[model samples]
Target: MTNPYTTAPMPPQPPLRPAPKWARKRYVLPALALAFFIGIGAGGASGDDAKTTAAKPKSASPRPTVTVTTTAEAREPEPAPTVTATKTVKVTATPAPDTGTVADDDSGADVYYANCSEAHAAGAAPVHRGEPGYASHLDRDNDGVGCDS
Candidate 1:
């Protein structure tokens, strides 16, 4: 009896077919993008055409012509006017007196703080020049405000 392991020869395998060439996304994406841009351009051109067609004049009319004429006459020259009289003038100015006190709308000039930290602690972080607890040291830029930081 033939051996159980021995089997009929397997039919020859069919030849493998080559894979179909696929369009790469790198090329296809750019082509699609170019097509989209061209479509948009075409749409814009068509829209402009529609507007121009709608705005076109129904009939053409001849433009009117203008004619200009000029005439000149001879005339005598006029005499120059003479000056009647002249006078001299003098002016004087005086310096105004200096005022020691500053005029401020807010009345907190007496309040003083040693530093920005002290002012911040006292709930007065930003102090203007005329406001209370404002000092030159607290304002680094000297913009008339203190404890700005």
Candidate 2:
């Protein structure tokens, strides 16, 4: 609600002074960037000088070559052996007298083996009733099943 034409009082201000040219921050960043690039260029130049002097040329005529020689052999293989059937010759002669001294393995009581495995392997197991090798000792129960153990 004060008068509109009256101006307000201005605030107090401080005095200014320039910083030192060498200590200012605006030029420090560009100077550091220039020094980094110079160092990298100097390092790369020293490495390239060694590769140019190590190269050398070689001659093909100075190397040696070898040539081999072998004696030739005859290629005819050995003849294979032939197989022939032999013809048996029969000699005609007179007959001899009869003899009854031949031995028989299946004698009286020693007919079957001690176990069924031995009897079956010898073609003698499961002898039915009234068969050639059937007997009372083989069929214990007399039910017609012999050597069933």
Candidate 3:
């Protein structure tokens, strides 16, 4: 039988050569130009450029005293009411506040409909945060709930 799968011998590769000096020194000029430009960008005088005028010594000029005249309305804000001594008065329940009732286990929607629906149906909701009817449970974000359309 003839050997149809036989292959010829491959030729040997040539020896590696050393790179030329110029090839080895590839980016010298570009790097030097970059450094030169960087030095120029640092504001140091180079080449022919020099001060056009005299190099005067720095002298401290008194900052012009700014006499800011404020209008009468711009005076200090009125001081808030100050209490001399904080008497630690105990929190005593006087009477149940007359605010409309919210039944336990009732959802906020139910509470709103039961309490605020009538008031708000007429116009914009009058109940606001910190008002008697304003429940944080109803408006968790405290951005005013149940009537300020």
**lDDT: which candidate is best?**
1
Model 1, residue 101: distance off in Å is: 11
Better of 2 and 3 by lDDT: 2
Q: Give all TM-scores, in the order shown.
A: 0.28, 0.22, 0.21
lDDT, candidate 2, 52-130, per-residue tens: 6445455467657698999999899988998996544332222223365543542422343444454566566786765
**Tens digit of per-residue lDDT, candidate 3, span 104-124:** 644333323233444455332
Ranking by lDDT: 1, 2, 3
Candidate 2 residue pairs in clash (backbone atoms < 3 Å): none
Clashes of each: 0, 0, 1
Give the winner by TM-score: 1
Q: Estimate the TM-score for candidate 3.
A: 0.21
Whole-model alpha-carbon lDDT for candidate 2: 0.62
